[model samples]
Target: MNFWYVPWFILPYLLLAFILVKQHKKSNRSNLFFKFIYWSFFYLFIYLGITEIQDKSYFFTIPVLFFVLFSWMYHREKARVLNGFLLNLFIASFGIYLLYNFLITQDVLVFALIFLVGVFVVLVGLFGFVGLMILFYWNALVVIKRESHSLANLLTLILAVVMTIWLIYDSFIAKMLPDWASILLSILPMMFFYFVFAFLNFLSASLLYQFNQPSYDQDFIIVLGAGLVQGTKVSPLLANRIHKAIDFYYQQRKYTRHWVKFIMSGGQGPDEKTAEAIAMKDYALQQGIPEDDILIETNSTTTLENMQYSKEIIDRADIKAPKVIFSSNNYHIFRAGIFARMAQLKAEGIGAKTAFYYLPNAFLREFIAIIAMKRKLHFTIISLLASVLLLLSIIAHFVS
Candidate 1:
């Protein structure tokens, strides 16, 4: 037998192990997509390496590796428990198939294994589609629930729930039928779901455009800062934010929400001459925001700190509970909420319009932020669960 396959199995794992060790020691972890890709490659290499070393069959190792990974995921404390469960199902189902093929004389076991695998695959697909729907609709519900009065809220919530249930029912029924029919039915629904989700984001932004400007009772409107170009001139990204703030200021004046103080929150970059807050103030005045109502908060750099520090300035004049709005790009609304909640501020997160090309990039950044904040509990649970499941499967393999 050619031994050339040995190094091929060993090299990727060696690199993967290196990266994993490096990442574990770092204060910040890498993106989930990268982590998954690296780990997948690592696991694949390990399975192949083990097969080569033990002179065992590839089929057994492949299924066994999947079982271990899935079991680890299942028992682990990650939010992806459903994923782990499905993977475990695949491994367990595959294991049973192998066992029946080797130990039983009947073809019925093979048929049963096939049936199990089919069901498992269908369920996994359903879970993925539904999970996406849940995430999207939940975000949509949050917007609707917040903006809508009680009557509207009730109707919207019911509609959302009904739509979700309908999707699940439709998927289950279609999958229960013949294979070709199932595939055909699944395609349109899944595409429609994604289409709706994509358009809902736009709809959400449109709703944001209707934010009432400050009239007579308005006190202050705050514009959150994005990173500047070279820490000096406002990046086009940040310009969008400033532009919205200017619009809000003018709109409020138009609607009789007059003399709203504009507070810009951001610290100066090391390379920039002035703080972001100061720069924003200058930019707004350049665009005709009166210098008197414009206050600059230049001390803090973070979103939370931006809010906190700005509130200090706002409170100096005995205006603590101002009907404040913090503006950021649309993708950042949820995270800005988290920071606002943390700072104990009474503020509504208003999203400014962002460029379409920039949104995908912005969303990726937000997703990474969410993962980093809750990684330990997530990773630890996932690892432990996967390990336990793998152990149980191993014991079961030996005993059976």
Candidate 2:
């Protein structure tokens, strides 16, 4: 057994220990990303060591170690969606590694059996596209029946149909196209998968944050407003947010000696009879909250404006070192938190429950919004990946 691979395994541990110490000293999202990267490298090194030593039995420990670390990180910060996503990716990579190892080491009979199973899985996946189209159409029709026929409401259904079509074309029709056209078509699926990965990350993070209980030490509770019904009354979505903020206020009062101020943030829209802030305030007062305890921010329409204007109100109140909590519907909390961060407000979020039927469309909209928020970065990554794929295709064409 060559001991040279031992140091390769040990190096990642040392690096991770340093990162862990840094994270403990000053925790932030970037630190979490670094920790994930380091942990992945740690596992990769372990796999390398196992392969070098020819100890196939040790392969089983990789996944066990992955689960242990994933659970520990998830327990530490349940609200971090990116962390969950990284852990999921790690497990997937490990599974692939195991499959590769099995193919290399197993007997011919076992290989043939595995190959047959693999082919079966592929065939099922191909046929599964039809099932996916059915599901998508059903969801689309249900959404159209229950909601308005607006493009926003139909986004998920539209995307599902488009993806299904693209997959079919890429699988069967791309090979018949010109080389450049085929390369471009092939790149679409990769980009789609990347988008799907990102969407899942944001959705998981949002859902995790929604389910976790808010801490009771907040100094302020901000309720973000949605559009009103008929431009006057509070919509069900907006009402849920106010109720969530009130619940948090009462929960905090049980533990804290200070009063938690409620900031109702929303401006009047062109279609509204009154400012969203005014409507939310009136609703909160009717719900039995004192007028003195509620502060109205009546000049903001968007979530970012909600954060910015609300922060001004918090500042005007002369509250020092305010720990704030914002409330929105569950699907909206992740993006709301991002907005709060953009406004330089140190705030956590609590999500009220949303209707189950509405969640998929809502989540899809939020995912698109998040992508738009970092459009430059996303464009750069997709362009680079596509370019590489195109280059590889061109090289293969020339070689052949």
Candidate 3:
């Protein structure tokens, strides 16, 4: 409405929208700043609207809700591949918080809600984060007992041990240590905080990637492979992926009348009788998928290779601007998308269902992988934090 608001709130939001739409049109789905920029503008514009309220009509909610509406509309428009689901979670919680404060002003009934919440908090505090930690350790034990002893499966176990050790040290041992020694050891949790941030980002990105789907008219469904059963048959895990690809292939063909190819991608392991891709293709065929529609890339042993080798096959197909999607288990889809981008493949992933009990450990493993993917950035921030902490300690010594 005013000239000042136009520049401060309107212009920047419109500019962000334009950049996102432009990047979206070009299929540049890798910009990690989109969510941050969008949400920043979202809260800013809302706060601005609240400040400038002049008994405006309901339509004034347009500017107040502009960024929220924009997020809802554009989120499914292939722009959500950038991740940050935690931002969405934050939006909901913030909205509820604001709504609660507003309604508390209206009636005494709201006080009952607050009182109930306080009571619930008190009850739950009896078995709070410590209880949560106990569950985490138990889950880790279950993962180790039921799954392989591989490093991936051992993630929960390792994390549990680290957390328990830190809890004991921070709770009991820190009091007896020398002041400087205690101060330095305090950096352990500070360092852990950085990794915790990375884990949250990874978790958010994984949820966002899985929720944002590809169009039904994709040209190919590249099924990323896993290991086989006893070196011959498609393991249930691998079969879940193939089943997902087939389901998508069938649904797309049925609804859109667009026949998509399946690129079964994987290689034989040291103990396998044949390539994982071959076994995947065999399973797909048994499910009544046409053999002509299934293509196999049998040389990929890792997810990275799956993307790279599959891209090579896709390039050889000689189609101009072909649309493609890959199929894998839900937890694996996010990382597979990263690998696809790394391989320069313009594709989205269609995630298959993962079991409930399996998700926590699988997500932890994926979180670790994502953290490893950006070791340099983490190391730099960590080093900077260490220097800051040491400087603060030195200053505190002199000040004291």
Best by TM-score: 3
**1-400: candidate 1 lDDT, tens digit per residue:** 2346546645877786777767655221223334554477457545434544454444545555665565465334222324424544564656564454434322343345567777887887887855755655665456454443444234334545666876776857755765444443444445444434433443333332223222234576778886677767887778888887677666666656456787889887777877888778878878876788888888887888987887787778686567777777767765675576567666665567775534543554554565466678656755665555556555655655
What is the Cα-based lDDT of residue 11 in candidate 1? 86
| lDDT on C-alpha atoms for all candidate structures | 0.60, 0.77, 0.73
Error of 1 at 289 (Å): 0.8
- Of the pair 2 and 3, which is ahead by TM-score? 3
Model 2 misplaced regions, further than 4 Å = 1-81, 93-130, 178-181, 254-258, 396-400
Error of 3 at 101 (Å): 7.0
How far is 152's C-alpha from truth in model 3 (Å)? 1.9
Best by lDDT: 2
Write candidate 2's Cα lDDT for 44-75 as tens digits: 54555456347444554565577567667765
In angstroms, the error of model 2 at 59 is 7.5
